[model samples]
Target: MAFDYDDNNIFAKILRGEIPNNTVAENDVALAFRDIAPKAPVHVLVIPKGKYVSFDDFSANASDAEIAGFSRLCAEVCAKEGVGLDAGNAGFRAITNAGPDGVQEVPHYHLHIMGGRMMGPMVLLRD
Candidate 1:
C-alpha cells in the first residue's frame, strides 16, 4: 500500500498550531514537545514540520538540512531534560515506531526521546 501524510493527525495539528503542545524546543525544521503520555521520566516527542508518514518517508523526502536540524533539536531536548550523555545515568533512548507492526499510532513521523531513568531492554525475547 502507498503511504500518504494525514494532515489531521495530532502531530500535524500541533505542527500547524491547530493543537497546543508543551513545546520543549523548536527550529526551522522541527519541533520538540513533552509527550502527553510519558513512558519515562523525561519523554519528549520530536517531529518535523514537513509532511512525512514514517521515519523512512522523512529520511527519503526531507532535505539534509531538515534532517540535521531535527536531529540536533532531539539532542537538545535530551540535554535540556537532563537525559543527555553528561547526565550521570544510563543515558536515553530515541525511538521511532514505523508501520503497523511497529505500533505507530500517529500517521506522521516522530521520534520519542525517553530517559531520566535506567530504561529496560527495548524488547523481550520470546522463547
Candidate 2:
C-alpha cells in the first residue's frame, strides 16, 4: 500500500526529532540525511524541516527563504561531497520525485542528491 505524506510518516517524525536520523547537513529550512535505502555512494535525502506533504505541496507552501535554502542546501551537499572537481570531483544529480505518477513513494517532499561514483544516464520517470 502507498503511504501518505502526512504527520504520521517516518520522515515527518524525523523532522520533528521524534526519531533519530543520520543527518549529514541541516539549515533553518531543510535537513539533509543519508538515505536509509541508498541508491548511490553519496546518496542524501534533503527534506524541508517544515510541513510539506509533497513536492507540489512544498512548492506551493514554501516561501522565498525556503526555496533559496533548498537550492543552497543542494550546493552545500555537492561541495561537501566533493562532487565537482577537475581531477574529477566526480558528478552529481539532484532529484525530486513529484506526484504518484512520478513514483514518489514518500508523501513528504525531498531532494535526492546522488553522486560520488560515475552515474548512469538520467531516466526521466515522467515525460
Candidate 3:
C-alpha cells in the first residue's frame, strides 16, 4: 500500500556499479542505458539515481534539481537516439509503469524510451 523503494533492485545495482549497463547518457540525478531485453530499436532505460518507487514518488519527493536533471536526461536520450521531433524522425515513446496493475517489474523510478519504428497502439483495448 506504500510506495516503498528497494535499494537492491536491478536499476539500483546498475547505479551502484554492481551490474553493468550499456549507458547511453547520464547526469548527477539519473542514468540512461540500453535495455537488456529491448523491445524496440532504441530502447533505453532512464532511471533516477535517488531512491524512489515510482514516477509519482519521484515527482513528489525529488528536489527541483533532480527533477530538472532527469527531464534533461530524457530529452538528451531522445536527441542522442535521433527520435526527437526536432529531427525529421517520427519521434519516440516514453513509458513509465507503476504498481502491480501497471506491471512495474522494478521498484525504482524509471522511464523507458522506445522508438525507431511505429509502436502500434499505445495499449490494446480490452473490449
Best by lDDT: 3
Q: How far is candidate 1 from the true structure (C-alpha RMSD, Å)?
A: 1.5
Once fitted onto the true fold, the runs of candidate 1 whose alpha carbons sit more than 4 angstroms away are 87-89, 125-127
Residues 1-127 of candidate 2: C-alpha lDDT, one tens digit per residue: 4444588878888988898999888899999999999999999999988778677777788998998998788788778877745436767888888776677877888889998877787884545
Q: Arrange candidates by lDDT, highest first: which order?
A: 3, 1, 2
Please list all clashing residue pairs in model 3, or write none if there are none. none
lDDT of each: 0.89, 0.82, 0.93
Better of 2 and 3 by lDDT: 3
The window of 10 residues in a row where model 2 has the poorest summed lDDT is 81-90
Which RMSD values do the candidates have, in order? 1.5, 3.3, 1.0
Top candidate, metric TM-score: 3
Write model 1 residue lDDT over 1-127, tens digit each, in one string.
Answer: 5457887999988988899999999999999999998999999999999998899999998999999999899888978988888666569999998888788889999999998888899887777
How do the predictions measure up, each by TM-score?
Answer: 0.93, 0.85, 0.96
Off by over 4 Å in 3: none
- What residue pairs clash in candidate 2, if any at all? 5-107, 85-89
Each prediction's total of clashing residue pairs, residues at least 3 apart in sequence or on different chains, is 0, 2, 0
* Residue 35 lDDT in candidate 1: 92
